[model samples]
Target chain A: MCELLGMSANVPTDICFSLTGLVQRGGKTGPHKDGWGIGFYEGKGLRIFHDPEPGIESKIAAFVRKLPIKSEIVISHIRKANRGKVELKNTHPFVREFWGSYWTFAHNGQFKKIKTEPLGDFRPVGTTDSEYAFCWLLGKLKKKFKESPQPESKLFETLEILMTELHQKGVSNILLSDSKHLYTFCSTKLSWITRKSPFGKATLLDADLSIDFRKVTTPGDRVTVIATNPLTSNEEWNLYKPGQFQVWKKGQIVFSNE
Target chain B: MCELLGMSANVPTDICFSLTGLVQRGGKTGPHKDGWGIGFYEGKGLRIFHDPEPGIESKIAAFVRKLPIKSEIVISHIRKANRGKVELKNTHPFVREFWGSYWTFAHNGQFKKIKTEPLGDFRPVGTTDSEYAFCWLLGKLKKKFKESPQPESKLFETLEILMTELHQKGVSNILLSDSKHLYTFCSTKLSWITRKSPFGKATLLDADLSIDFRKVTTPGDRVTVIATNPLTSNEEWNLYKPGQFQVWKKGQIVFSNE
Candidate 1:
């Protein structure tokens, strides 16, 4: 098994608080210690950091935990290496450019023989079933919408159908983004929380740390955090039922199949 | 204009010493201060860091400069924003995956109105002439070589033709890599140096830093560094002539059109 963390914000925000807790599970609190990767979007430019080392001991991971790289959409993963070997090429939160937009995806579950399907233009550089699925997802989208752009609702509709089909294969708990929206699908375990005005203190579940959101955030700020498991003990997290798909934007769920 | 720095080595090697000097040109030593980026390939896995801020003052740049991350191939750039706005999307050292390998590219010079060419599957996430040229190059390759992997000689020959076409459009000093080979084409300024058994001391041109290769490297290691302009004043560097293309492997020029 693996883990995933995602954030969407109305304004540029940092994931340091949530990241601190997640890194603990990468080795200390959990067994997902093979490697880790994270992606943050600053406008259309996406910055990705991949370390094929345990996040608990990686120097770059520590550097990222302290650096205040702000982004409107963020996705992260810690791997346990169920389907692929523990290597940099197999690190999660893979990114590819499609339709003039940078899309990022990370998976938290395993599947077999997912590569049995024919591929389009996108190909996986690694041997992970997760990456193969991502390539399939993006390749299908690129082929369907080859021209300019498509309406968000139409795209979401297409994605829902695809996700439903993919969920039938195996566990498909995934977090994906197309630079404009954060799309999450629940096949097994997933939870999410949104923070806005009147934010209070929240304590981490995995680490010995806590943050006073009222001191760090403005009233206008709205942020949504989605993860495989709840990272905080105090905050109320909404659990997603199996086969549910949600599209989030500006820190809130804009569309959902609950 | 902008600046480029690349490395190819038989053994995994850290580029911190060379990157330290190149980042200085981002703002402290030169005028190419719009943004900066670098990609390091650990096997087929690539780790890329991009900053829209000037490298001189970027905390992430500072972090990357000190890290001991090693790679067999590396590509980096410092931008001056000739044809695009100063944004993260427009940063240099753009990457795309093809043929089950991550290909990275960076350009030193630029021209406007290059998007007049019809694009294939690959599209530019940023509105930079450099990225547009890269997409065209890769899209052509993906279309022509849609089967399995082609022979390296055939691929290089195709690249040489594409380089000639792109060079005709503008000043196309570029450093590109397909994880297996480092490809460079010089329309104007580019230089390279190969370090072998007889290690020597070298000094940076932009920073007050020096290193003795004897202390850090083994006798069997071979490394080649390529840059838009010579990075070290103390080393003997070979300058590439205009319209020359070189394919480098394991720190040596395996093929070239001198």
Candidate 2:
């Protein structure tokens, strides 16, 4: 099993504070020390770093901690081998190009006996069920929608139907984005927190770190963070109901249907 | 390294569509197939799943693909070995209880030569620096605000300073949450997207998938997603600039300083 961390903000921001606390779990406070990767969105582009080493002890991780990369959206992961050899190719937060945009993906669950036909356009570069699923999904979407782009509502509806079908096979919890919006679904555990103008204090549970929101943000800024679990001790985290799904855009909930 | 996925929305929604595509990366499309884990925030609690197998081939992953777990917030991760022998103990998305609330954390990146003195209350259960960092952060937060919670502004100010110091040591891209608000910092790469009533078509770059947002969401809903990279091929993704910090609350950016 692995862990997940993400951030969505209206203004460009760095995830250093939350990441500082979460990175500790990679090897110090928690287990999950296998490899680690992170990606930052800069306008229409992405900056990514991946390492086949424990984040707590790897030099790459140290470099990342020190670098100050700011963006409106961010995604990160730490590895714990479950399938495939521990190598660079097998790292999470996989990236690919499509429709002239770079797409990245990562997973934290296993799928059994779930096989899909070889995708003509998209193929697996590695041998993990997660990759296979990604290819299959892409194939399905391409098949369903040709050249014309659909509206958000229609797109979400199709996704909901597809998700329901996929969930029938096994457990699935996921986070996805294309730089414009974030989508999430849960078959198990997932939590989130949002910060706004009426800021307050937040104490980290994994580390003895605390932050005062009032000083860091303005009245107009809004931020939403999603994780597998809560990261603070003093804040109120909103837990997703079982079999729930939601989407976030611009620091606010855009769609939800549990 | 592990992979992370997250979503936030105004209305309840499922991430099955995105999860399906992401799952493929766990073991099929890309790599990251050592073990997988997921967390879904349900109301005030979280539903979680951890599997010590490739998500593409694991039975649980298959089942999850079809599950309909829904939520306003979601987080997921896939693993690839980097530290600690591959086993359940080393999985990511580590959970802890603090201030009567469940906190979760996930890290991407590595740290080296971390020799910070061990704190009193928090300690590492694993040899990974990630856990040590978590403990250190928690310990620091506890020590800073031992008596009462400070204003969010004050807390964030202190955290910013601490994060800047920690960043000087290593690569640190992280996500942390207490259910109400999310904190993010990027020492490296991270990206995000937001969706609202005027949703449009989104195509997956890793897979041949696309969604029409207009079909599934209401006009009042908004969603935000953050990741290490973008997941779609046609949508615009916002990247974090170098050396940035920010906070998210209620689906909007609350504080930011790049």
Candidate 3:
């Protein structure tokens, strides 16, 4: 199994404090230390870095920690090879291009020997079932729609049907983003937190670091975080029900079908 | 290390299809499956599940695959032992409570020998660096603000300074949420995708799946996905620059300091 982390906010915010604690699990504080990766969104563009070494020891990881790049959205992961080899090619949080835009995805579970037709346009670069499923999803979307995008409600309906079909195949806990909004679905375990005005104190469980939300945030700011686990010891982290899915935009819950 | 997956949208959406592909990596397609977990937000509450086995083989994972749970925000993860032994206690995606709200986190990196003060309100049940970091972050927020949350810009600035300090110690890529908005920071790698009107075909890079945006989404629907890597084969995946951070809210980029 692996860990997951994500963020959404009403204003541009930095996740350095929380991220510092999370990274320790890559090789130092946790056992995930197979490989590590991260993604940040700056406007419509995304910046990414990945390494096959434990994040605790990787020089690239060190560089990232020292930098303070900022964006409106971000995603990241560390690898613990299971079916695929522990090479750079098999890292999590795969990226692709669609409709002249970039799409990013990361997974935290596995699928057994499931086979599906390959779309001519989408294919897997690695030999992971996770990648295979991504291609299949793209294929379905392309086959169903051709040119214009559908409305949010219609799209949600279509996705609901497709998600149901895919869930039948195997374990599926996923996070997806296009630099604007975020979407997620859980088959097993997941959790989340939201930070807004009247911010309170938050304490890390991995490190001794602590921050006062009142000192950092204003009444106008709102932030939501989703992860495979809770990052803070003092905050209330909500758990996802089995077989649930959601979509988040800004700092509020814009859509859900759980 | 660990893997992370998340989704945000302008409206509620199901992650069934994408999750199916992602879970395969937890122990089937990849090697993260030391344990699996996921979280979904429905209204103000959250649904969560966890398994101490490969998500592909776990009954819980299977149930999630077939279930139609949905929300506007979601988070998920699979574990790869890096710190503590493989057990239910060492799963990714930790959760907690603060200010009458749930806070969740997941991480994908490692920190070196980092030491901090113990949080007064938060403590770790597991011995993972990821958890420690969560506690430290929350503690700092509490100390800085005491009770009232600051503005988003102020929070972001404070985070920037704190992240820079942590980067000095080791690698850190993280995601934090409060069920409303998300905050992400990358010390190493990260990527994202946004789907909206003028949608097109998307091919998965890992699996043989494709989806046509025209059939599933509306012109009014906008979604963003962030990950350590790209998930599609036919879509352009943007990479995060080193030391970058961002905030996601309302299906748009509200603030970025990249």
Top-scoring candidate (lDDT): 1
Model 1 preserves the real interface contacts to a fraction of 0.91
Here the TM-score of candidate 1's chain B is 0.98
Residue B98 in model 1: lDDT: 86
CAPRI class of candidate 1: high
> What's the distance in Å from true for residue A133, model 1?
0.6
TM-score of each: 0.98, 0.50, 0.50
Error of 3 at B233 (Å): 42
- lDDT per residue, candidate 2, B1-258, as tens digits? 656666766666787777777778888876888776666665444545556678788766676666676666676767776765555434555544344344556666666655455663454444556555666676687677763265677766766666665666687666666555556677787787888768899988777878898998788877887776777888898887646777766467777876
Per-residue alpha-carbon lDDT of candidate 3 for residues B1-258, written as tens digits (9 for 90 to 100): 766777777787777766777777878778887887777765444555656678778766776765666566677777777776665545666665444345667777777865454654455556677767776776677578654365767766776666665656667777767677666777787787878888899876656777787887778988777776667777787776878877776456666777
State the displacement of the C-alpha of residue A210, model 3, in Å, after optimal TM-score superposition: 1.1
User: What is the per-residue lDDT of model 2 for residues A117-236, given as tens digits with 9 covering 90 to 100?
Assistant: 455345555566665666666557667775325677776676666655556656666666666667677767778898988888888888788888888888898999888778898889
Which stretches of model 2 miss by more than 4 angstroms? A116-120, B1-258
* Global lDDT of each candidate: 0.91, 0.68, 0.70
Over 4 Å off, model 3: B1-258
TM-score for candidate 2: 0.50
The sequence of per-residue lDDT tens digits that candidate 1 reaches over residues A119-176 is 8878999999999999998878878887535567888888998888789888899999
Candidate 2's chain A scores what TM-score? 0.93
Q: After superposition, how far is residue B89 of candidate 2 from its true place, in Å?
A: 39
Clashing pairs in 1: none
